[model samples]
Target: MTDLNSKPEIDAPEGPAPEGLEIVDIVVGDGAEATPGATVDVHYLGVAYDSGEEFDSSWGRGQSINFPLDRLIAGWQQGIPGMKVGGRRKLVVPPHLAYGPAGSGHQLSGQTLIFVIDLLGVS
Candidate 1:
């Protein structure tokens, strides 16, 4: 039998994000929910939509990252709230909410970013 709790593969979207950022829960957690301004620790995989290339991932390095929810990119700041600790979420962030027209680094210029995030803690 398949484990119901297993995480599915998160792929970049080929189509446009439907009006505003799209947030979907992959695995629901019973822990505390993340709030604005909260310092959160999470594991995230970032993919470029155009070529479905992974630009970054905390899981690859076997380490999680911690940052204030409000201090991240506009897309992350808006989308991270309401996520529960130990939960996983998928976010489809459009250009405006992402890095905008300038984008980030060389691989992500003017790209729509897709992220699969696992919320590890909130403090």
Candidate 2:
């Protein structure tokens, strides 16, 4: 069987990124290092910056989701590896790096995303 989850991109951005998100500054991981184009598996909790409502997570995957950091929302792609194993952090990702102008459908449209991430283990 094919693992439909193997694609390494989130539909790609249709045009320029949205109007709010910023890259801040990229931080490197300690031992849990993840390069710009590498994948990082992790556990996380994501919330909407506007409504503070929970949007998505891998915590309920019954295990950690092998989140391909490179393929993830730009916020995560740049934010996840700035941590060490067992480290926790808050990512203030603006929408430009998140879902772009369209915002990944409805849940994220015109909004920045706040994420509380734990660098449980990186593979």
Collision count for each candidate, in order: 0, 2
Cα lDDT tens digits for candidate 2, 47-99:
76666667786664546667667778777876665566545556767767777
User: Estimated TM-score per prediction?
Assistant: 0.85, 0.65
Report the error of model 2 at residue 66, Å: 0.6
lDDT of 1 at 80: 90
Off by over 4 Å in 1: 1-8, 17-19, 103-107
Query: For residues 59-105, what per-residue lDDT tens digits would candidate 1 score against the true structure?
Result: 77878899998788888999899999878888988787887776356
Worst 10-residue lDDT window, candidate 2? 2-11
Q: How far does residue 6 in candidate 1 sit from its true spot (Å)?
A: 8.3
RMSD of candidates 1 onward, in order = 2.8, 10.6
Note the Cα lDDT for every prediction shown.
Answer: 0.79, 0.58
Error of 1 at 95 (Å): 0.9
Error of 2 at 108 (Å): 1.3
